[model samples]
Target: MIEQTLLKCEEMIQRGSSSFYKAFAGLPSPRREAVHVIYAFCRMIDDSVDEPEESPYSIFELRSHFQNLDHAEGHFIWPALRWLFENFPQSSKDQFMLQMQGQVRDLSFTHYETMDQLESYCYLVAGTVGEMLLPVLRDDSNEEAQSAGIALGMGMQIVNIIRDVGEDLTRGRRYLPLEVMEKHGYTQQELERNVVNDRFIAVLQELKGAALDWFKEGLDNVHTYPPESGMAVELAAAFYAGILDDVAASGYDVFRRRAYVSDEAKLLMFRRTAARYPSPFGGKGAAAVH
Candidate 1:
């Protein structure tokens, strides 16, 4: 029954984000199912905050719902999440709390004054996801691998911020640090207007540079995971990094269009990453996995 529920969660993830599903494809079943459950939980929380009209519960009610997980009766997500917490109690609770805290911030905190503040927000929203998934990928005792996972999560969040500038502004949020914007002579007013000028481009370039540095630092230890898990992380990072490349290819005109990696490009990335890592479940690197 739990397996069936987890399969439903897997379908949710596949429908919501094909890129993430692509990354998860390389994992063996055990880790893959764990990841699906985690993703489903995160998706539930994110939707509760981001789309209140569609959500069954309000943010406060969502918190209450999760807090009462032991008594949760009808929902598939609660049972799936309960199973995860029962099996991996070490970090899942704290990580979920942190993720919720970040969502709360999203409700009230729309602007950032410094990079430090922005990074803290990123860690809460994305880093905790890394923390949650680390145990499933490998032993929970490996501190270094856990740290790398957090860093990689942060890098991915930063990439999201960089890519979604226009969309974020439309929603009345400015994720870029106010200081960085001022330093580049890009004002909030200009950003809200979706102005694509040289200064705005420079600001984006700086943000992208910072994101790439985090990606490099975070993914430096991809070999830490068992072959397939490592390849999954590496491939996901490569896909996110490819978005950076797309942004550049668009000449940093983020205000003009959303940037994305093509499915063909992702397949190529999978092949290259698989070649570099040499998967244990391999026929021909990622070709067989996909």
Candidate 2:
């Protein structure tokens, strides 16, 4: 029964983490399974918050699942995540933080009043995933590795916020920090208009700069990975960083259209990434460790 539960959980995670899973193909089987389990947990949390209909029910379901996982002994995903928590002495799993996000989602509290607030929100929903992943992938936990993972996670999340600005606004959600918008003299009305205004464009430019900085920070930390463990991280980071380039090419008109990298561009990125680091794991990939 536990095996069946884990398999079902794996299926759910694989579907939710299609973006992450593609990169995991480069991982060895054992490491790949850990990544899958991590993503499954993230998927469960995201579904609780993002599902448009029956989201209330989804939150309850996730809470129930976690309760069962904590008290019982047979669930596959539970034990896998539990093993990761137990094995990584330097790590901490803030289940309370995870539960808090479900509450935030339930309230549809997506808008932000300041960068600090946005940062806090990012840490909960995305950075926590990074913390979970680092312990699973790295042989030894390093503060540098954890910091880089958090930055990468935050950068990816900001990219998602930028991409979804329009849709989110339509859904009565706004993720752009109010401080950034007001600082630039932009308005929620302007966002709702979804026009290519100079003020709006400038706001996006500032946000993009911030995202790029985080990406560079994440890139710097990637070297801490012992080559093999770093492959998936490199792939996902490069993939998400490509979205920033997409936004740039669109002239920062994120309000008018959501920028997306083409499949060709992804293939080109994959090819370039593969050429630069032949082995997904360690070995020569470490030579680039500058």
Candidate 3:
């Protein structure tokens, strides 16, 4: 029964986010299964708000069940959560609950006016993910390591905002800060019109630069992770960062097309990563130390 429950979680992750699944698949045993569970719950929480009609549980229901997980019933996720908590007692329930709180923001926030607002939203939605994964992926969840993890999540969230601008507009949501847009001379009207002009490019570049900066801060503590895990984190960051490159290659048409790194490119990236981390771990540098 436990095996079946974990398998359901695995399927949820494999179906929902292949990139995430691929990056962490190398983990051994319960750790790998744990990642699957975390992703599945987070995905469900996100879908509950983002696609309420289709989600299995309302956001409120999810929180209730998660808060009372030991006796919670009625879904593979509940059993999976029970197993996760049983196996990893150190896991932070607070981080998981905070994630639910973050999803609730989508219910009311339709537009953002300041970088502070955007950052707070990003932290709630994505930074918490890093904190959630820290204990599962690394030996130490110290303040510095956890902070770096949040930075990585924030960077990835910025990339998501840049890539999903068009899709977001369809939902009447604009994550880009009004101040940044104004500074770049790109008006909200221009964004709504899908005008891919110089100012638009500037706005994207500004966000892209910010994303890269956070990525650097995020990776600053990579060596603190287990070798294979460090490699996986690095790879996920590389793939996300690649989206910006593809956007540039597409002449910045984020409005009409979603940019992606090809499977072939992923293979090449995997090879480079494998070379760095090696089979028995320990390569060098900030990624695979000693």
Candidate 4:
């Protein structure tokens, strides 16, 4: 029954996130199902917020729908949470995702006054997703894996923020914190115009540097998971990293357009995954075992 539901989730994600479906293709089946389920839920929530033609309903109304689904508590996450809770033990970290997703649904495009606030928001929305997936992928509940998972999510979120500069502006959203902009001498006005000045480039570089550190941290931390679990993390990390490559290749022109890895590049990433699949922790093989 769970397998069927998981397949349903995968189908949902396939329709929602073509980029992710392609990247996750290299993941071993065991780890792939859970990641797909989680992503399906997230993609739905994100669409509710980011979709251009979404209903004119207020953020509160949208949040209320999920809240009602969960009986006014954690309904937004019920689609995924109910499955994990009824079928699998609820990891403490997984619980955080339910609450965090609700939080995101409640708030639309929070304007950050400082770097710290932006970091915290990113951790809540994206980092927590990584943390939640760690237990499912690693097949264990441990501090090291949880911490690393959180960092990995944070890194991915940073990359996403950098890539969405132009898109977010069009949507009346800005992920770049105000203090960082001021420190670099860019006003909110500059952001709206999507200016591509040297100061803007410097600010972006600074954010990119921070994201790189989180990616490094995530890579190191996932090493503790069994080799099979590590394979899942590796696949996701590799896909997100490709975004960075696209950003750099575009000369950080996120102000003019969004960045994306080409179909050819995505196929290459899939090939790399097919060529190597070690144990999540350590082992030699073409695929990781749970």
Candidate 5:
């Protein structure tokens, strides 16, 4: 029954995000299942806002049930959460709540004003994910690793913003800070027009610089994580950072062409990760994991 229950989450992860599912799938059973559950629940939370038709519960209901998890029922997630906490009690309950809290912000905060505001939003939505995964990825945690985890999460969220600028606009949202645009001499009107010129590129470049800094900070102590987990983290970061290069290759026309890393590129990333760390499962190192 438990195996059947968690398989639902495995399916969810497979369907939701290839980079995530592929990166964590290699963890030995307990850790792999734990990552799947965490991602599936997070994906469900995001879907509740962006694709509510598909999610089982609304954000408010999710928050309510999550607050009362032991008695929570009516979904695969509750049982999955039970298994997760039962096995890995070190996972942060507060971080999970903050994740839901961030989604709640998506309801009213459709647009961003400044880099500061955007960073706060990123922390709510993505940084918390770092905190949530830290315990599961590593047995012992400290301030340094915790901070790096948050930095990585927030950095990845910034990449999402850079990649989804066009899609978000279609949905009446803009995450790029107005200050960023103004500083680069780009304007809201230009963004809405899908301009991909020097100033426009400059704006995203600014964000990219910051994102890279966060990625560096996040991975500063890569040696600290268990070897396989470290490799997985690097692979995840590579897949994400690779998208920026794809976006640039397309001349930064994020408005129409959605950037993606190809299978060949993903294989190369896996090889690079494997060379840096030893692992038992051994990466597929072939056929696009992303």
Candidate 6:
């Protein structure tokens, strides 16, 4: 039963995030299945907050279900998550709680006033995923690897915020720090009006610069993981950072259209990473990674 559930989880990831699915494919057996379970659980929680009809009640239910794991026997996500927590107790518990905290924060429809506040939100929402995945990606529980993972997740989340500025406005949320916007002479009113002017572009450039620095920090420690895992992390980081590149190529007009990295670009990135490393994991097609 758990096996079937995990298979469905894999399908969910493949459909929702091809980049992550591709990265996970590089992992060996049971570990890959484990990661799928993690992704599925996170995806479920994220949807609870982001989807139009979903409500805070779903998050409350999740909290209740997590607290009473044994009573959650029949639940699809709980069983898998229970297995994950049991297997990776240290990494799973706190990180999962932090993720839930971030989701709860999303329900209030607030704007971040400062960069620190935004970073805190990012750490809870995305950095925690990195910490949770660290145990699965490597045997050693070192601080450097965990830090790098968090940085990687932060970089990706920042890029997501940059790309989704217009979409987020429609949802009555703004992830960008207002302090930074004010510093760049960009106003909330202008943003709401979908103004893509010099000031807005400047704000984006500053945000992108910070994101790129985080990516560099993450990539620097990518080699800390075992070869295959390191490659996977590297590929994932590159693919996400590629979106920022696409945004730049589009002249940072995030309000005009959403930025995305194509599948062909992803495949090319995988091949490039494989070629650069020259490992047994290299030269295989996307399907081969699975």
Candidate 5 residue-wise lDDT at 238: 89
Cα-based TM-score, every candidate: 0.94, 0.82, 0.94, 0.80, 0.96, 0.94
lDDT of 6 at 75: 59
lDDT of 1: 0.83
lDDT of 2 at 199: 84
Model 3 weakest lDDT span, ten residues long: 281-290
lDDT of 6 by residue, 1-290 (tens): 87887788888788788888887687887678778888888887888788837533387777777778777865577778777766766655778888989988999947889999998998999999988899888878878888898999899899989999988888889998999999999999998888888898899989889888888988887766787788888888888889989998988888878898897888888878888665456754356543
lDDT of each: 0.83, 0.69, 0.86, 0.68, 0.87, 0.83
Q: After superposition, how far is residue 74 of candidate 4 from its true place, in Å?
A: 16
In model 4, pairs of residues that clash are 70-75, 226-280, 226-281, 227-279, 227-280, 227-281, 228-279, 228-280, 230-280
lDDT of 1 at 34: 83
The model with the greatest TM-score is 5
Q: Against the true structure, whose lDDT is highest?
A: 5
- 1-290 per-residue lDDT for model 1 (tens digits): 98898888899889877778888786776778888888888887888887888876776776787888899766788888887877766645888888989998988999999999999999999999988889888764577777788898899999999998888877778999999999999988888778888998888888888888887877888776788878888878888999999998998878879999998998888777766764355544455345
Off by over 4 Å in 6: 52-57, 284-286
Query: Which is the winner by TM-score between candidate 4 and candidate 5?
Result: 5
Residue 71 of model 2 has an lDDT of 65
Once superposed on the true structure, which residue ranges of model 2 sit more than 4 Å away at CA? Answer: 1-14, 52-57, 72-91, 99-108, 251-257, 278-290
Which lDDT tens digits does candidate 5 get at residues 231-286? 77888888889988998899999998989888688778887777766434354432
TM-score of model number 4:
0.80
**What is the number of backbone collisions in each predicted candidate, taken in the order shown?**
0, 4, 0, 9, 0, 0
